[model samples]
Target: MKKAFLASMLAAACVSATYAVAQTPVNTNNGAAAQGPQLSADEYTAYQAVITATDPAAKATAAEAFLTKFPQSSVKSTVLEQLVAGYAGSNNVPKTLESADKLLQVDPNNIRALALETSLLKAQGDSATDPAAKQSAYDKAADAASRGLKATKPAAVADADWAAIQKQVTPYFYSAIGIDALTKKDSAGAIAAYTSELKAVDVAATTQPGPVLQDTYFLGQAYYTSTPPDYLNCTYFATRTAIYAPEQFKSTFQPLATYCYKKFHGAEDGYDAVKAVAKDNLFPPADFATSVKPAPTPADQATTVFEADKKEDPTLTKTNIADREFVITNGTTEQAEAEFAPIKDKEVKLTGKVVSIADTTLTLAVSDDAKQANPLVADVSVTLTEAPKVAPVVGADVTVVGSMASYTQKPMMFTMTGGTIEGKAAAKAPAKAAPARRAPARKR
Candidate 1:
């Protein structure tokens, strides 16, 4: 993201003022009277021009000279604003922020000044590599945003102006807070920030549904992706979504669940499923919960997913490579083929569901234990030469024709050169269209 550039507010403001040093008022008095010379309109204009110059060093020198020459000029506010902009553009954030603070003392409701101040403080907070520094920066950014909002007259302004402020202030504030919480692993805090964003989205959705959806989608997706180990402190966000936007969740939260199941499973899947169901109406099909098993230990993860030797059962004999089940490891089928090449002519029994069948890759979920232990177990996604004639649903039992090799970085996924189905049966009964959920009525 591009850091905000200096806007033209200052340029517009500066055009109205001009002064010259030669116009300064000199006082020749007795030793008893030693007051400084008064800077007239021309002198003040000269001072302002130099301070507002584009050259960094010259601008700094001019700023100091202006304060010294006209310590109390009405042009001080404009001068300070310019100095802040010049210093900021020169990469002197501290000086820029300091000038902004001074400018704010004169014009507390100055939006441009407040913007520069907030951006500077946020940059500082973000740059602090240490925890304490980062937290402080996040807090300061939040405070600055709040102050800006209060100073702003949202009701008095036109809708477009009000919306501009909301876009600039609300989301950035929430994002700063949410990202800070994420860094600390404070799931609850992250949820709180995202919830604020959601509320803003809901309000904005009344007038602008598309933009609201786009923004809210990002916020919701962020919440879905932040699956902390054990779900440490995210129960509130899940519960709140259920209570507040059950309808919205019902429509939009399932895709997030699917993503979670694909990215992380096992204990993680439980949290993912709970959040999904709470916000939305969908549940993981019972069979899906039984598939993608997770291992209790690292060693179990290594051995359980890839068993070495096995004889095909006559009762459970599969038709071809595509009919048997298999999961993709980090490695490729060509490597697996080479490893299992000697046994290429040999037949092996594999059972799994076609997790996905795309034009290029075919992923399958194989082991029942893996499916159950980790509902989001990694599946075998192989490059296919041609699109498969069959399409696989999320939860379906199928058989495939393929051979396994010693697992590489990629799992030893079976490449479905071709195959036929051979499964006991699907655990799911069926899917039927259902009515939308509604909240109960309240008593008078």
Candidate 2:
């Protein structure tokens, strides 16, 4: 998962350090020459041997020998730095980390050492088996990144070279910190770090999209997981991730964007427009705003149902069972009683999908006046005249005939007695009211 992140850091470290070395002229201040204490002829010769070694393995061996022979040498930090670079060049992880630690011991603010240590620690954290060990490694990596962020350019490095190094290292530093915050469930901290990381790099121009896209996905998750979730922003960032993600990751992130957009807007109707906007912008436009379509009130829905029924059947009155159920569930008591009067004991037939079956009761989600994707609204609960030998399947369409019994508002459940399946007349017995049970909560 973190291969891209580690690869980018290794490439950047090699390129930045080598570029700086090639561009800068050799001098006493920047070279391997001893600084504070004047070196003896033998000590200077040893230092020269390490610096002039033709290969990384040879340089590492010579540097290690120099460090062991002259522990108090003025050029100890320089030798350790060479050892770090040499171990890194040879792809010797343990040796590189050991060398980097030794370099930091002598020069605590060495930018290259800090960056290397932080990147290595993050990789270790990602692969750690024990949770405690993982957290510890991530914490140390985050600490190193924090210190590296405040470190000034090394005195030996030219301004241009230092700027280039900053461009290469800054994003990875923030990425480590951001991933650490995420591991700790600090969403706000993750958001801040990832935001800074994205700002530090040209995300659109990045040759390695895996890490950047992964971070964008994590950023969206941070917004979603924050208290009082910022769903609008979540939608934007999640959608942005989908836009840039590889084929395999698109399916994972795209739905998150759609889900958040639908949740914030109360429906999926206008999500395409949001997805379109995300394709062209990393963040929402400055003038961006979503017109939230508030869910219709129960009373408003009842009124709409009443008007539509009247339009379909001009002679039909609110006393009709369906209309009565709507008004009784959504209207004031006086209006409810008035509409429920004629339908109380009258037998009526209903067609709907069997949403649930509990004992003798079958809950049917009726089509008319029922909101799409919401089963709780406009559901009819029918108490069977007899418990059928074979129960109806939950999602199958069914027709039931029953006498209207009672109703409940808010959640809008209808109770019916003397209920019988259309073709199961042989199962009929006697009418009896059943106790109402709450429907199981829907899965998100």
**Model 2: worst 10 consecutive residues (lDDT sum):** 435-444
lDDT of each: 0.47, 0.72
The list of candidate 1 runs beyond 4 A from truth reads 1-39, 47-52, 153-166, 180-189, 195-259, 262-444
**Candidate 1 lDDT tens digits, 163-215:** 66556555445544555565566666766775575555444342222322332
* Each model's total of backbone clashes: 43, 0
Q: RMSD per prediction, one decimal? A: 16.5, 7.5
lDDT of 2 by residue, 234-321 (tens): 8888988887777776787788887777666656777777777777776568766644443355566666655565565554443345
Off by over 4 Å in 2: 2-37, 154-156, 206-208, 266-272, 291-444
Model 1, residue 51: C-alpha shift (Å): 7.3
TM-score of each: 0.38, 0.66
Q: What is the lDDT of residue 212 in candidate 1?
A: 29
